[model samples]
Target: MIWNENIECASRDSMSQLQTERLIRTVKRVYHDVPYYRKKMQEVGLVPEDIRTLDDLVKLPFTTKTDLRDNYPFGTFAVPMSEIVRIHASSGTTGRPTVVGYTRNDIAMWAENVTRSLCMAGVTKNDLVQVAYGYGLFTGGLGLHYGTENLGASVIPISGGNTQKQIQLLQDFGSTVICCTPSYVLHIAEVLEEMKIDASSLKLRVGIFGAEPWSENMRRDIEKKLKIKAIDIYGLSEVMGPGVSCECTHQAGMHINEDHFIPEIINPETLLPVEPGEVGELVFSTITKEGIPLLRYRTRDLTRLIYDKCECGRTLVRMEKCKGRSDDMLIIRGVNVFPSQIESVLLEMSETEPHYLIFVEREGNLDTVKVQVEVQEQFFSDEIKELQNLTKKIKYKLESTLGISVTVQLVEPKTIERSAGKAKRVIDNRKI
Candidate 1:
């Protein structure tokens, strides 16, 4: 099947009509197949016929993470068990895992979306793609895996961990592209330096990093260290995994797969749509979804949208890299703090590494925020006085940058836990 061709180059009216038609069909499918969706539509006094066009979607109830969790394993599934080819779930740190099902066609659609993402990233059939994301229920690994193969490239499914082996594969296999989280890329760069390996000699030309928010400064740092261009990929398992949107070679922002997925931004509190260029929670509507079609699923990911045509010649709507999540935002002493902000400051500090944990706790009536940083190996000295001086410098710099008092604890190098999958960079103890 041909994936929507006009998606990246169509006029606005053309895209809207395509979305409306798909939305009508998806609404009818959900109303007939998914019991949960039927109940939801009934609760809102909305029948499938009530939704005539894309504009009418706002009148429908929005789906949330809680909705997916409430459904559990197969409650939201629209197809029969025999039709489902595979299942994936979220990390489930919150509660019951949010499950997703894919049919044979759904799998092919996933591959097509990922192939489009790679094309945006300038990947070609001749390139050797090295996938470093963790495989399993996590969508990052297999998402890129299918995409690389679909794009007709040689794929090395070197899913995360084993930094040394990852480097070796880059050298031996002549990998031209890599996909992993941004921090892991930095960690691999540090390992390469220790092994006296030259980054340019590895033959890696592009790096696609996501699964967490990162800054442009961090992107520049990764590019400098790995001697490659860095592109961002965005997705959630609930919204069909890592290839829902991707950065174009233009490097402005990520282009949403507007043909298959409708993107909207809304105020978290009011649930009213926000104007473009304004930051708000993102809501996704799966237009061509088969097993589980989501209608206006509240992502809680804070980002802005761009409607202008990209330099890469794709007309798909672009979304800015997420600034942070509403649920993950930390409030300490009446100040809103995001881990990404702290990470930016750490990257600017020459004496610090990317590994740091935020300790947020309540001391009596006041909330205290402490940033624990591991000293860089090259900067680590045997003298205790030197370490103390380093801690003082970090604390002073953080205070000046964040405009908030924070205690800085300097630990020995390689002390913080290195995550094989998603890096846990923040530990909030206030709830405890």
Candidate 2:
């Protein structure tokens, strides 16, 4: 089910050559059109002419969220606002939202990538797709919507939330494909259970999930509960949203669209490329983007690369499931912990639900981490000894996995608030 066979299955050498040409042209365009990029290049003592090939990518300056924020609004845009056809932004929870713009060509490219992603997931024009990601400033909803439409598949522009409505549409519309955050899909599964709706009654066969890092265990849970092939889609609003890369039917790893966006792995601390197949920060450069072409943008996501040809026969580079973000990492007692680690532990145990929260607090110079997870309704009990044993078992497993003592609190099912977008997995009070 590979789409755009020429590009998706292109040889590594050919793809590299294509990337080199696009990278060179993108650099020249940005240098002449963007003052900020010109200044950054000048600071690095390099010009567009220096970037002769894809291998010279390391010579360019790295862009970060701060750089986009400092540039603000349209600062990083290579073209005038008149040419910008659309605008999208992050939630800006930490500060001003990192804004992104798109020219008509950029939107078409985005649509094409997403359409290819849908095909990679085995979606076709015959399947009805329901897109439940959030829209507007957030890129998930509209991104999936356009791609589904471009694929000639019937798309339900149903944005996030309205779980009851989502379920109703799933039934009435007979939607065969769903796209949303992994956590939200879990939430939908939970509601289905509560409502006593048999998943077998639905027509869903494939789910495309992203916007948050989910573990293999979580993926298994999603597949088992929903009875759908869960495919991971990777993207950031800053880097052209959800269709940047996607997993084929093989589901081994997400294939990066190297022709439009070049992918790299670098040691987050040393700021150098890591050894092949090593886990590190994920960086991207959008060579085909027009309104906002970025050079070596730091995505902060932690993942490794897989270059082997996929079973589905695509030769594009694949990125393993994201471990977590370097910045989203919690440094508790000098040991790094990612929520996905804790999530893998809980889901593997089979006694707890997928919903959980991590709370980090500083007690006198020492940092303490607490995990509040929901126990399955069948496992929840008032017996003090039984509850204590369950808590101890979970605590021990987590301590072994995270290498840090954590206070584990088991709560009743459905205790944690659910989200239709990115789940709030961590609550770091130390920042406050």
Candidate 3:
């Protein structure tokens, strides 16, 4: 069932050699054609030849989101505009969107990588995949669309939104595989319950979820609700869409396509490489991309890497599920909190649903956090004493886990807003 066995199962030494060769050519290409990279290399008094080995990757300057913003549009692209067959950009909530370009070869390579990822998830030509990620400027929908076709699987490019229609299609089409954000899949589960359709009525066997940091508890919830094997897939628009890495049937860690993209974990503050299996910021170098090759691009995602061979028989390095982004980490009352941590605690409890929101507010020069959680229909009783006990239990659990006292308010089912895309987990109103 392994796709592209030559690349995915290459020996460590063979892979390293392949990466070195690709890195050398990528560096030389960017050094000459891209002014941004050329200037970066010149400022460090380094040349393309200095990056002859994989270890020499440390010599190259790191590219950040700010660098992409300063460059704008196509400034970071190595090839001319005519050569770029496709363009994609981030949502750019902070400022100008980080733009990425792709040549024909880049597109082909992306399809190949995603095909490998689909195969890893146990998707085959006989499966029908329903792509629920957004299309157009966003990469998720189209990325999975072509990958499913490339894998010889029938694809339904349903895109996002239209919940009722999504459920109808899932039932009518007998989709065997689904690709979308984890949150949206949960939303689908809620809709399925509302429609009074048993999950076994359809033929869904596999769910590929990504585009957000979700917890293992959330995975279990998804599996229970949808009755499908939930697999995690990781990627970014800056590096490549949804195919950068994916979990196999083992579900241990996501196997990175190291033959095409080189991954490094570095301390966010010190900017030094961390020891293997240590939590740090994840960085990437696009060694095989042609239109816009990046050197040591800082991804800001916090995770650790595993180099041991996976039980799935793939030798590619694997990364633990991302805990959270460095920038997304919230500091409240001198304590660091990740929304995923809160999510894990909430999902572990049977009285509450996966839907919740974290609100941080400033009151009287002090920062306070209030968590709004959704209570299951059976748990939403009007008995005041019962409600009080449930709230106290949740508050105690959150305080024990987060080391900070938080107000827990239990709302009725479906009170929190549901997301059709990436879930909005945190709302910080503190004016700091």
User: What TM-score do all the candidates reach, one by one?
Assistant: 0.77, 0.78, 0.78
lDDT of each: 0.83, 0.87, 0.87
Runs in model 2 lying further than 4 Å from the true structure: 329-432
- The TM-score, computed over Cα atoms with residue i paired to residue i, of candidate 2 is 0.78
- Candidate 1 C-alpha lDDT tens digits along 224-343: 988898999999888899889999877899999988999999999899998768999989999998878899998889899999988878889999998767665564432335576677
Worst 10 residues of 2 by lDDT: 328-337
Give the clashing pairs for model 3. none
List the RMSD of every prediction in angstroms: 11.8, 12.0, 12.2
Clashing pairs in 1: 8-315, 132-160
Per residue, candidate 2 scores C-alpha lDDT tens digits across 160-265 of 8799999999999999999987767887898899999999899999999987666787788889999999999989888999989999998999999999999999
True-vs-predicted CA distance for residue 349, candidate 3, Å: 43
- Ten-residue segment with the worst summed lDDT in candidate 1? 329-338
